[model samples]
Target: MSAVAESTAAFSAAASRELGEGTNDTPAIAALRSEAVALSSKKAWPDSRKERPWKYHNIATLDLGRYTPGMSASNGAAAGVRSCPVTGEHAAAIVLENSDVIFSEASPDGLDLIAFSALIDGRLQKLVDERLGSAVAAGTSKLTALHYAFLAGGVLVATAPNSEFKEPVRIVRNYSGGGQFAAPHTLIVTGANSRVHVVEECRSDEGDIVVMPAVEVLPGPGSVVRHTVVHRWGTNTKVYTEQRMVSERDSEFVSLQIVAGGGVVKGHLESSLVARGSSSELYGVTLGTGNQHADFFTTQDHVGPDTRSDLLFKSALRGHARSVYYGMTRVGLGARNADANQENRNLLLSDTARADSDPVLEILTSDVIRVSHGATAGPVDEEQLYYLQTRGIPYEAAEALLVRAFAGQVLDRVADEALRDELSAVLDARWDSPE
Candidate 1:
């Protein structure tokens, strides 16, 4: 293992000891937890002066230590907590509240589903042992390390080879009010020649809460997977999200992330094409208003020949809100005939609002077919606003129209019609009255 991984494994050991050992954990999981705990002791919240990831982040302004661990109670059992309204009869719903799985339903023939807390020792153990933490290796990031060391609970989902699901699997997680820390983990594996779809939603009630969520997706050879994530937390919530995926030979992966709520949110999304003939599309949308702050980091890695990847992320900022985006597209050595693209665009709606974008590309192979990255941050175009105003649109209405269109560029990519319409309406309501 590398020095960083060793440090994290050590931290996991110590943190897990103090965090309370779970008797349900199998030997491998227990060992993994120990390593994460060992690394946690040496790592602290990101420091603007010391960590590049936190350099543009205002860490000193946030009081994260005040949050306590989440209670092991389901929202259904708690008072004043509301369930998500976005549900369909055709979809399977898994509702997670705090550290408990409140509800889960899926067809046995469609998906092999199991809860992480339920895997003590058994057949699933071998698969979990091999795939867990394989994509985002331990110690890659401090927050990621902490997530592994102290994950609250999550589920594992897999589809049988050549099987198909007619409807999407919807996973909804709700965090309740209080200074609570909520950590949720998810692992998805799709078998060869199979197809799977998943839609995940994260929301919270009114309160000061901190949320830490991690997800890993593995698409087996010749598989196709589509996933969507929507985050809509209250103003007092701060969230750190980690999402990673590894695609195998001849597999295809598509993902879309929509961020619209939370006082402060930071996230990392990565797509790693680890085998030849793999392809992926990554898309994201961020809408910030008031004093909201949103930051997203992304990576597209081509580690095998004949791989292709593309990424597009858009952000709209109003009021004194702030937004930042940084991305990297890397082609590995000997990964010839690889093609990758990274693009980020930001729109500022007020003089006080600010946005920053950085897109980078690293091509390590001499025969890289094409690799490019571009970023742009600017205000609403005056010409376009003027054109709208001249056509009888009010100034504020015209600005809103353009802003909604800017964000819709990404929202429109969502393949689910219901989700797309719901998100579009929410986006309109959110930016209609920006400060």
Candidate 2:
């Protein structure tokens, strides 16, 4: 067998040994895991030379055989991880450490927050069974297949029809220990006419760890769903994240990703407007320092008539950091009157810092209202820095201010003031001390 296949087999064997140890695994779940392992065995690892999305990152250097699947954390093992609320007030909150739930608050009425492992025995079993893997399938990529094969702890968030959650639902995940692989998944299903917001935060202790996190959102007709994820992994952690959303007729979906930590991070964020009148808004912010690397691929797919989407991603790099962004806005042949826009901006703070950005648009229909994209990467404007310095601000301080303002453009678009403030604070903290 090839090296990739051998690694897959070894990891699969390790996963199988601890497969249903601490959680309920129904036959369906077991079958899904087995199928994922089988699919992984046939897939080759991504080659940077051959794949556009993998071009900036060297995936061959990562040895999957060196890391074993993480098990559930023992009681009190999460003492160092706190479950503080990011948005001040929340309808529900769950704290996960090493892919194990250590603390969880009761969900509000009309909202069901159940562990993915408990789905088979819970009241929302049927709903989860139908929608669990609908938005992001395991066969989407080789890494995704591995994610499902060793899937350990996950959560399912389901909303009742016509319900509204004034407060956001929060999830905080913390990872520690060395040479371990962690997979955390979240499946969200919204009912028709429902409105909800979800906030997820990720942190890890200083260690060599691999994390594959996936989130899939399915918005029902006329529903409004918002999601935000913050990455604050340790400097030694390698992270790969996948998040996708599918909007139904007249539904709206909004998502934001904040990447500030990790040794090397790569991921895909995608939104599909599958029904008429559906809309989506996507935003991302990345702050890289040290030798950190962050790479992302995003897609805005308009598959139905009168669908709309807008995306903005920004990155600030310092030290020897690097950032890469590839985005595509596609209007299907049947998507009449579709409107889409995409933008990516990068700021290089140091001479050695690097940024690569590509924005593409593909429109099949001539009846589209609008389709546009823009991308830019460069160093801090000397004129702006001089202006700030002339006002008695130190050069370094002025540069920092400019960088914050550059990233603040996207943060200003957040709908919730409280959440926006919290994220702004996080940005400042990460910028001031990016170690």
- Each model's total of backbone clashes: 14, 0
lDDT per residue for candidate 2 within 1-435, as digits (tens), equals 576675665577456535645456565666677778777768888898998889899787888877767555756764644545344778888878787777777788899887776565456887766776778888988788888788877888889999999888988888888778888888889999999998888998788999988899999899999998888999999998888998899999999889878898888989998899999999999999999999889999999999999999999999999999999899999999999999999998889999998888888899999999999889989999999999999998999999989989999988889888888988999999935
Which 10 consecutive positions of candidate 1 have the poorest summed lDDT?
75-84
Number of the top candidate by lDDT? Answer: 2
lDDT per prediction? Answer: 0.77, 0.85
> How does residue 116 of candidate 1 score in lDDT?
73
TM-score of each: 0.88, 0.94
Best by TM-score: 2
Model 2 alpha-carbon drift over 4 Å, by segment: 1-10, 78-87
